[model samples]
Target: MRIETALAAVAVFSLGLSSADAETPFKLGTFERNGRTFPGLVLEDRWVVDIAAANARLQKQHPSWKALAIPAGMKELIERYDGGLRERLHAIANEPGAATPRVDTYEVKALRVRPPVPDPETMVNAAVNYVEHGAEVAGGTQAPTPSPTMAPSVPGLWERPANDIRWTPYLFLKARSALIGAGEAIRIPPGRDKIDWECELAVIVGRRASRVSVGQAREHIFGYTLEDDVSDRGGRGDARHGSDWLVGKSHDTFAPVGPFIVPKEFVPDPQALAIRFALSGKVMQDSSTARMTHTVDELLQYASNILTLRPGDVISTGSPAGVGFTRNPPVFMKPGDVAACTIERIGTLTNPVAAGP
Candidate 1:
């Protein structure tokens, strides 16, 4: 009798716990505007939509489409989530006396749906971290760039922008300003020559870390996202004093990150993903993460040694073989072309290239 009673109590407790867990309100719903359906945040109907929906409506309303200016509040939301911000936004939506910007009146629809955490900082990209890219760029065999002294200080030391000779694990900073949500248009800067696309797996930092060990490095990661390190490959591959990677790589819409942030809990083994890229709907770059010369853990351990990586910092663990510049005939992006970058678990990030400033 006693044993039976204990088992019953255990079952009851488990049931109660599951019931309680279900109460955690997570925003989930489809965002629909002007008769079109797209994934969107689920805020209380009162939340503002001007920034998210305004431009979409305008683009639909007008023929001359302009990129929607990122809203001011978007930054605040990203900052909050960067600090482990997760909660039911509904209470803020439902409370009679909650913050203003009510549901129905807001410009964007606030249907309930989970949104990604804003990255705390921009992506710290390890350039030519792959052996193949290094070899191709050198126009010779894959001779490794002498690994910089494995210390904690080397990551921040490489602060140059894109499109330069990356003899080492040349690190560069992609402006947080350069980030674009998935499915958005990637504006091709005007008067640009040699626009090339690189498919890379970007690691998202999960926790505060400094000098983390390689074994513990994966724990500091939240998950991963996809980014196209679109660069002006023309001047960059020159093997000269300064290839203009910075201006080429940092163009307004050069970096397209998203589809969604695959929370780390879902991806147990990130190093083994398959990454592929398609241009104008044709497969151009195809390879696996296994080809990476520097593993994700090595990259993280090396980066943390240099700077304090706060939650939401991203490291784009280099691209695989088959970048456009590496092609026999050299395939470059042109206007009216859609480039698709796919990595296992992270989903596909597709953007239509448009001519713009």
Candidate 2:
């Protein structure tokens, strides 16, 4: 809600890139942070360089469309429009004054990215979504007895004002203000070590939805992208896990998002996909979405049943196995480290760990 207030603080940001200068839609381009080289989609076909800017342009272009009173259904219409969304984006690529600062451009060049829908009003994370991860951490059959310490506890205990070590979703807000883009550098917090990474897919809500049925949950999702749920394992063993998690996970640049947002239409099935993480060129985690005990739809439906899902809300589906906490001596991120999370279909997100002063 303070978004309007924040944007108002800036009169204009300068970008030295020229517009296409014709009635062409901008192509979809993948971007990287800090000028790093990486793979990206160069779709000259059509796409909006910036959703907010395009909306303003659309209002000026066809007054008739305005009378139609269509909200920001551009994403939906783009999927079904004449040439489809990409095609339409290309058509208006050169629209005057509809361009955004190139500095914020999602280009292939090095630059930071944040959750497209940063500052999600509500956030939820699934627990034990990955069966194998659950098995590895809990050790089943062979170690039938539940680790008394591993049982789910009250939520928001990971890192909160108070701490409860009991296991649960242990959810907390990373503060929308703290989100940074993929390829951005993450500052290792002072007085903290044992850094950990949890690779998970994030879902963005399309509209104001509540009590959305499991069958209709897909309708609620606008798209999906990659997010690395970086953690502070040193904060473990606290009584109030949620409070601790809030602090541990809310450190600046803890949540890295984006490479390109693959809309839900592109991913008909959120399950049956593979997710992984690589740190400093070493494979740290590899698991399938199929391993999640609760599917995306299920997680959405479950969370909505409890609260209204507003547009831009985020749900971090649970992570797979191989967390640093479970290692022999435990493996945590150190200064000058590079970490990446790759989800099948969704592009991989990589970030560098810079030591704190």
Candidate 3:
């Protein structure tokens, strides 16, 4: 069968798809081998196929294929994929004999995986984007208050439209320098005793967008990945600017991102994915993206209204109701503990906890 024929067969995609049946069925990421790093396509969730090398081989054998030049990095790939570059990727994944002996392939278990997008220009994180989470942060018992008496408590973000339309997503900028790849360590900065974890679905931008409408926001999205927005709840140890986020969210190794990026096409309904995080083998945060008080498109539209979102920027859509700082006695991450964030379609991002000076 022709490559195009096979490609069309798998082209039909939908809301929820296992990696096996979806188009491409693979994700894009960066892997380290022989002490060097390069961008590659992770296939069947086990093998890493070197895009540049594999494409060159496919070209030598199939001269009729109109494949564009392999992108030098993940960011470049995102920028060019929609413009006549995705077909070549489809051929690599769907064509039966696409993997030639000459094509470079490595067992994922044998190599080191790095952050797919090492340096996004910016990262905007949402606060209380989930109602149940808002309840937890506000000192509730993880459920909404059915009856309010004195001060008019949070009605669990007050119900959507009633909330989503009246309220804009609360966002904070996190320094890109805080990013750590999968399998790395989430270090506790010196002098901070209360460290917390925020597991979120990170939306990756594919285009340069400024003032875009909510309807057009989806067009600028590239894919989805996971990020652990590690936090330092001990404040700056003072009372000045009690609302300062930099002191709590911008420490190095605080944002643990990646494993890989599943293209938006594969994830038809980002809101349908299951999001959960565990610490030291215990499940802590568990909820679905459907609980998000504001949808991804609405968040993008609001953010683009303030600043241009360029290719490779990330938006952490917010966490659910199980953060450590708001617990009964409060549970915090300590040295030697491990944290793992897993999204259904996107892979898991695991990192160990450490104390740093």
Candidate 4:
């Protein structure tokens, strides 16, 4: 499809106001019950409105009105999301309490919170997409040394000016099975000692996209969520290749995502959000999405050109500087460390570290 036509299609599907004026009316997630998962509306910090049950109630009154299909899951909801579904959800959410049906209400503490898109078809992550992060990964500059008989030399540093660098995003794939939800334990595997944390802003794709342009990228996005891209630095490389991201990145519980997915309308400017993470009570990685070398749209555009992006596929834009491995004393997460990744507008995803079996 023509880029403009594709963009217009996205606008029609977007349930709320355009990103510029979109307020986060509500958030979406999944909660477990009796070994089954149900899509839910995050009404508040500790409460959720079960969309599946609410839709069933609505179906009884209006048999033909099936905005939220029965047995709805977050993945299915994203695929069928539109203005009508948004309105129906808003109506149910705005009803007066006590008078409203209490059967659909659930406390956050009483159930298991699953990943926003628990079964994403694929999970793509950007590596070193922040300028400072790239430089730090490459090893920062060394101070100029003084010479006994000659002038001191200038320090050597890596530099990539805007005009000199290509706008293309460098992307990599992470295992879909690596996903773990909020409050779950990120088990540190046996024999791997250097486990690090990379707090990132994750983009959830709402539609199927292939060869999409940057202008239409935002429309394809379902919403945003927080992801802690945990890495096993010790398993990063071996003799055959200098770097093996699959080994370093795709371990079980390496990708801790969610808390919930906030729709794009709520996030006016993805680039302006403050992204940070704290280990235990100590702030470790702290930065802003504004520092990213490639914007969300640019990354999506680049990825679409290479492969088709399906609904529920996640694209983690990238992490900022302050990763533990790059520090002077190189810090890493240990068993019992609680890592919490927080992004502005979105929410925090906290997971504890445990030794793997």
> What is the clash count of model 2?
46
Give the distance in Å from residue 269's predicted Cα in candidate 1 to where it truly belongs.
0.8
The superposed Cα distance between candidate 1 and the true structure at residue 199, in angstroms, equals: 0.8
Cα lDDT over the full model 1: 0.60
Looking at model 4, report the run of 10 residues with the lowest lDDT sum.
151-160
Better of 2 and 3 by TM-score: 3
- Which digits, one per residue and each the tens of the lDDT, describe model 4 over residues 215-307? 899889989998999998996445686878887898999999998999776687999999888999799878899988878987888788778
Off by over 4 Å in 2: 1-106, 110-112, 139-173, 236-243
Query: Per-residue lDDT of 1-357 in model 2, one digit per residue for the tens?
Result: 233222222211112223322222222223334554322222232222443345445656555432222224333332333223332343334333444334223434433344454446666666556766776667552212334555343342222122333233323455564577766777788878877888999887766678776789887776777778777767646576343656667677777776556656457588978888999989989988887666787677767767788766778898888888888788888888999899876677888998863
Root-mean-square deviation of Cα positions for candidate 1 versus the true structure, in angstroms: 11.8
TM-score leader: 3
How close to the true structure is residue 291 of candidate 2, measured as C-alpha lDDT? 71
Q: Alpha carbon lDDT of residue 139, candidate 2?
A: 56
Measured by lDDT, the strongest candidate is 3
**Full-model lDDT, candidate 2:** 0.60
Error of 4 at 120 (Å): 0.7
Assess each prediction's global lDDT (C-alpha) against the native.
0.60, 0.60, 0.81, 0.79
Alpha-carbon runs more than 4 Å astray in model 1? 1-119, 141-168, 236-241
